[model samples]
Target: MFEQAEAIAREMKISRSAVVAIALEEFIRRRIGIVPLGEKSNGKIVVASTDN
Candidate 1:
């Protein structure tokens, strides 16, 4: 996973944090459709798909 992120960051010329942030943003946008970012959840860690 670290290697993959490094590859992506290198190819995109972005920081590792940016890569993670972008992934998180897309995840929240897709899964928690109605809720916005930074909202508290139900204390459950749902598995986000990595099909892209």
Candidate 2:
């Protein structure tokens, strides 16, 4: 996950923290059944639920 985020930060020309922040916010929105309002980037990211 760190590698993926680092790659995104590099590609988007944003700080790692900024990338992580956006990702977290989008995740929270999705968890609550809200359509995330984040900028729609190219390419798809798939996240799945799992029991810890």
For candidate 1, which ten residues in a row score worst on lDDT?
Answer: 32-41
- Per-residue error for 7 in candidate 2, Å, reads 0.6
**How many residue pairs of model 2 clash at the backbone?**
0
- What lDDT tens digits, residue by residue, belong to model 2 across residues 1-52? 9999999999999999999898887798789765555334354343533422
Candidate 1 per-residue lDDT over residues 1-52, each given as its tens digit? 9999999999999999999998887687768673334454586445553544
Model 2 RMSD in Å is 10.1
- Report the CA-based lDDT of candidate 2 relative to the real structure: 0.74
Best by lDDT: 1
lDDT of 2 at 40: 43
Q: What local lDDT score does residue 10 receive in model 2, on the 0 to 100 scale? A: 99
**Model 1 — TM-score against the truth?**
0.60
List the candidates' TM-scores in order.
0.60, 0.64
